[model samples]
Target chain A: MNFNATLIGQMIAFVVFVWFCMKYVWPPMMKALDERKKTIADGLAAAERGQREHELAEERARESLVEAKQQAQEIISRAEKRAAEIVEEAKADARTEGERMIAAARNELDQELNRVKEELRGQVVSIAVAGAEKVLEREVNEQTHNELLTKLAAQI
Target chain B: MASDTLTSGEYIKHHLTNLTFGQHPDGSWGFAHTGEEAAQMGFWAIHVDSMFWSVLLGFILFYIFRKAAKNAHAGVPGGLQNFCEWIVDFINDTVRGSFSGRNPLIAPLAFTIFGWIFLMNFMDLIAVDLLPWLAQLFGQHVLGVDPHHVYFKVVPTTDPNITFGLALGVFILMLYYSIKMKGVGGFFGELAFQPFPKWMFPINLILEGVALIAKPVSLALRLFGNMYAGETIFILIALMYSAGIVMAGFGGLLQLGWAIFHILIITLQAFIFMTLTVVYLDMAHQEHH
Candidate 1:
């Protein structure tokens, strides 16, 4: 228990141990701790970045979906409008053909009626000539008779 | 003194004395034959047991920590690594809490002080008779020496020399950091200046110098007093147990209870010693305007 040379010996031991611990023990352990801290921080940062990128990707996907739907609607509407225009043109073509056919039929009917009237006039003129011949029982002047017949034909 | 001849008081006295080796009063160099002889040998004598046990524990601490350091990794730690890291983290926290400066030595110093002193103090937990009895047996059988002449004091921290030695080391570091942080002029000025005032320089010097010197003294005495008292109690219990079978049973129970309580004392003493060292060094590093 006396204060003695053990003090010096223990002091030397303490100093040497401190030096050993400083050189060997402390730095690596602290470095490991710091490394673990930095790694955790970096991992957290990376996770956050991944989450943000995922959200951006989702947003882009949604935007493209909306744009695609709009394009599809435009294509459908354009097709519908073209079909309507085609139907209108087909109707106008059918109407013009029907009017031309009706006009030709009417002209043919008028020509047929004029032809029938002329045939009826020819029959009547023949019958009247026969009767006159039977009544007179003699020949008449030919040039004057022919002239009267032509005039009769023009009237009919 | 032979075991059969010793009174309870003499027994306790025997347990309390160190195995001192130094110059004898007859002006020869040798081991002190008795406690009175050790004390009479004066300042130059070394406590062989204290030096041996303390150095052995210090080396053991160094070896274990060095092994742990060699195998240390940044990955998940296993058992030895985990324990080592926990100790490192604990010391680091203590230093960070107390020390504001960036010196690298403080953390490791705290670690060594805590671990080495704890091991030294832990020596007291061994049955008081166990080690000395073994040494006596070895001395008698192996060395062809008288068992009565063989003395072994296992608890190093119980010795004033060792405790004071540790405190002295801290004191040196304190002075070193004081000069390093504040410069030589500032350190001397601090020692000579206002706890009173600059005009009362002489008075301040006396007051502050006493306070400065008191730091290591208190550090040493606190650990020494606690450990020595605990060791004395254990020795008393051992003496009681040696009295008779009935007294032995009662003493055994008391010994168990005291040993359990002493664990806390030993650990706390180690903690206090380490903490004060850190605080003292931190105080030294502080730049007082």
Candidate 2:
């Protein structure tokens, strides 16, 4: 409505406020905003790094699991091969023992056969001598024929 | 209302009057009781109400920002600090956009202007008679003065002087920068030899000089015109309250409607003032014609 000293007062007030705001208000606030942005960026970066490490850890665990399975399979295959070898060795040893027992039994049988034959021959010679004695009706030549009879038995 | 004893003209005049305090032709200095008395007090008379509200608002502006500055950190902002930062951020963006110069002063100046002017204009939305009525009551009861003699205009932007004060401050800064960035001769040359040849300096000077002066005048008058017109409409609407019960209801609705509309005007005017100030300062800093 009117012009007065209020304009000067308003301008002075303006100067004072602008000075105060410039000195005390603007800088710290902008600094805070910038710092907050940096903090957020740093936080995001850290989160990304953590996630990458987690992925790497997962991969290592998977690799170790694969290695353990391969070792288990190898150990099982070795055990199976050794068991088969043991079974084969047992079969060969049994076959060899059986053959040796059979050979020994055959040798004993032959020896027994020879002895029996000799005995049979001796019995036959004795029987023939008895017949001759019966026919001759005398015991005079018994001691003298003994050597012959023995020789006959040996030849038989 | 006690104002009912007054005619509509007198009532409107009463609402329009400022609480001017100055000397009379009788060589006595005191508060002016009427518009004529205020005018007769000449240029020496001060609008005490405008001074009070403007100073108080400025104080409030400083207090809030100072508090925000005190506790500022890169943490979650509390309510008051958040509000302060919201305003600061707005001013910063405006300065960044319009003011290419890297001056620390522009943002702060823009902030002060926006906040102070917005707060002052916001007073216009309060019922036009509320503070003046309060002033009247205090004058009558406590100070033993006539209630009719106590005038209070709450909205500081409505006053041409306050607007001019703000505009003039910006203008001075414009001149200061204009001279500082471009030397005194360059500043004068800008006014004397632009959009025309060097030989046509007089016509260019006149054209450029008017354009230069018009910046502050238009800035001040533009704000003053909008706010003053809005304030007048409010005063006129207020008069409708005394006519009858129906008129009072109608006036309330109109007041509410205008106030809703005024929210736009107040904000837009503040924004425009700030943007223009930034643009003008940018112009001052530029080396181009």
Per-residue CA lDDT of model 1 for B140-169, tens digit only, reads 899878766677899999998899999999
- Model 2, B58-145: lDDT tens digits are 8887887888888888788899878877877878888898988799898888888898899999999988888899999999999999
Distance (Å) between predicted and true CA of A50, model 2? 3.8
* lDDT by residue (tens digit), candidate 2, A1-156: 667777887888778888887888778878876777788899999999999999999999999999999999999999999999998999888898888888888888888898898779878787768877888886637579988888877887
Model 2 spans with C-alpha error above 4 angstroms: A51-156
lDDT of 2 at B79: 90
lDDT for A59 (candidate 2) = 100
TM-score of chain B of 2: 0.98
Candidate 1 regions exceeding 4 Å error are A47-156, B1-4
Docking quality band of candidate 2, CAPRI definitions: medium
True contacts kept of each: 0.82, 0.78
Q: Over the full model, what C-alpha lDDT does candidate 2 score relative to the true structure?
A: 0.88
